[model samples]
Target: MSIRRRYADCRDGQIHLREAGDPANPTICFFHQTASSGVMFEKVMARLDDRYHCISLDSPGFGQSYQPGEIPDMRFVADRLMEAIDDLGISTFHACGHHTGGCAAVEMPRAYPDRLESLTLIGPVLVNEEEKAEYRKTFVRPFEAEASGEFLMTAWKYLELIGAASSVDLHCREMADHLTARDTMPMAFSAVWNQDVEGAFRSVDIPLHIMCSKDDVLWPLFERAGEMRPDAKQSIVGGSDFQPDRDPEGVAKALGEFIEGLA
Candidate 1:
């Protein structure tokens, strides 16, 4: 099925979305990783649309979504996302997020417990107070665009470092997302870093799925996540960090099976 790009209104502004499949099917709302947009979930949405209604959102300050007026915490983003989802008339749905998006997902159960049916976290940043402190120092502020256009290479190199850009095409695609949200990308990262994601993860009382690829940078945290929520469903897919973009088949299979099993 073809993906339809649209916008949903929220208190802040509009949230850009890519949707597919029949609305009659159970819905799975996807949240993309930092510096990327809902476009990252297109392939996976296409693969799973037959079994589920897929709605992937471009979080506030990312992609085509409105930029946040200030550097907000993950909770703020999560609440705004649910507002957009509510605007779409989805009363209940599954929530899946990657990295930064995962941070926002965990907060959803706390703020809107009745709305989320389950939570799926892909390569979530599970860090302690000390670790968060150190990591927050890495991106204390956003990078300034250089006049010589060298900032473009900086963004490309950053994506490569994170395993999000594995090829020329992928790099180009992600680079555009990075530059498009250049001002707020760092703010998003800061929000994730500042928030207590580990605490938020522990607070989720509903069904949960924690996933990561072996080659993903957060692979080390996969074990830690399992230890925290041993009862949660888990899967290890084949891909770098950008699994939905690079390994949609594996992602869709794992995600579809988990969601169906819950039913």
Candidate 2:
């Protein structure tokens, strides 16, 4: 598959995206985890090359894209995302998001119902006030940089713990994703923390596919998703927290089946 880096000018700001597969085919837009970027979707897109125009967008403040000041909530993130897609001349497309990206996935249908064919939310992470409070201490709140540089190592350690069973290459790439957006990690976390999982899914009129790794930090939330929407498709893939990275082939295979069914 041919891969190209592209950009789109949206209402909020310019956004970066990674494009692959053939544009003549149906489009499938992907979003990555908080503190992560489009890099994670490469393998998955490669697998879908002949069948779909796969795209992975870098969320504002997380990749080469500029932040949209104070995000406020997930709705704003969804709107900004749609703006970029619209600018790309994609009137409608299937949407996929992982972790924090999953929050945006659910919101996108609500933001632009007519523009979505389906939604695939991987490890949809939603935290209650108590979980948010605990994460705040770990910089779910705005992170204050320390001269001691513990903040920098904290990212690495967190990746190691979450992806303990993943390959070294996966860990290094994910670590880089966070370090590259060090300033906005908290902002992404904040948006995800405020998401209403049940409310968002309840509002989705389109078909949905929810999947998670047995080892994802948000696997429990993924289970809740199954309970909330029993009729929607669900799966438990094998991998650690970085399921997309650790199990791209599995992710892509599942995505291919789900998307083909949409046709």
Candidate 3:
């Protein structure tokens, strides 16, 4: 199936989306990590389009989406996304979020439980205040452009340190997405830092699925998530931070099975 890129209007502005599969099929929405866009799930969407209608969104202030005048919290982000989803005429759908997107995804069921059938958190950051503080110190540094183009190497090094720069092609794609959101990246990270991530994780009223890649930096967090909610389903795939990019088939197989099992 071919992926169609489009926009959905909301109060804040247009939210960009990349969609695949038939609209008549069960919908599964994807929200990507910070400094990235819906393209992160492009390959995974292709693999699952046959079984599910896949819609991956570019969060407000990221990708081709309109940035709000001010930094918005996770709840605000969630509401705006629901508004866009409403514009698509979707009443209920499964929510799958990665990293920072998981912060917003967890808020969806809390505010609009009826609209979300299930929640899937991939490489979720279920950290405590202390851990958050540490992350805030290390992970949210600004990626400013320098006249010498020195910042480009800085960004590349960071991605490489986090195991996201596996291939030159993949790194280039990530850099493109990263640069698109560079100006507003800190705001999104601030939202995540201030969010009650664990509280939102606990408040999920619908079915829950916690997933991660064994090679991801957040793999340890996946284990912590299981400890928090032993009842929620869990799975791990092969790949580093960019699981959908590096291991699309594995990501698709795991996600497809989890969603189908709920049926």
Q: Which candidate should be chosen as best, given lDDT against the real structure?
A: 1
The TM-score of predicted model 2 comes to: 0.94
Model 2: how far residue 187 lies from native, Å: 1.2
Off by over 4 Å in 3: none
Better of 1 and 2 by TM-score: 1
lDDT of 3 by residue, 1-263 (tens): 79899999999799999999999999999999988899989999989999799999999989999988766688888888889999999999999998988888999997885988899998989888988888888556567687998888888887887667788888888888888887778888888888998998987879899889887888888999999999898888877888888888988888888888987
lDDT of 1 by residue, 92-133 (tens): 999999988999889999788698999999997897778777
Error of 3 at 127 (Å): 1.0
* Candidate 2 wrong stretches, greater than 4 Å: none
Worst 10 residues of 2 by lDDT: 136-145
TM-score to true structure, per model: 0.96, 0.94, 0.96
Each prediction's total of clashing residue pairs, residues at least 3 apart in sequence or on different chains, is 0, 0, 0
Q: What 10-residue stretch in candidate 1 is worst by lDDT?
A: 135-144
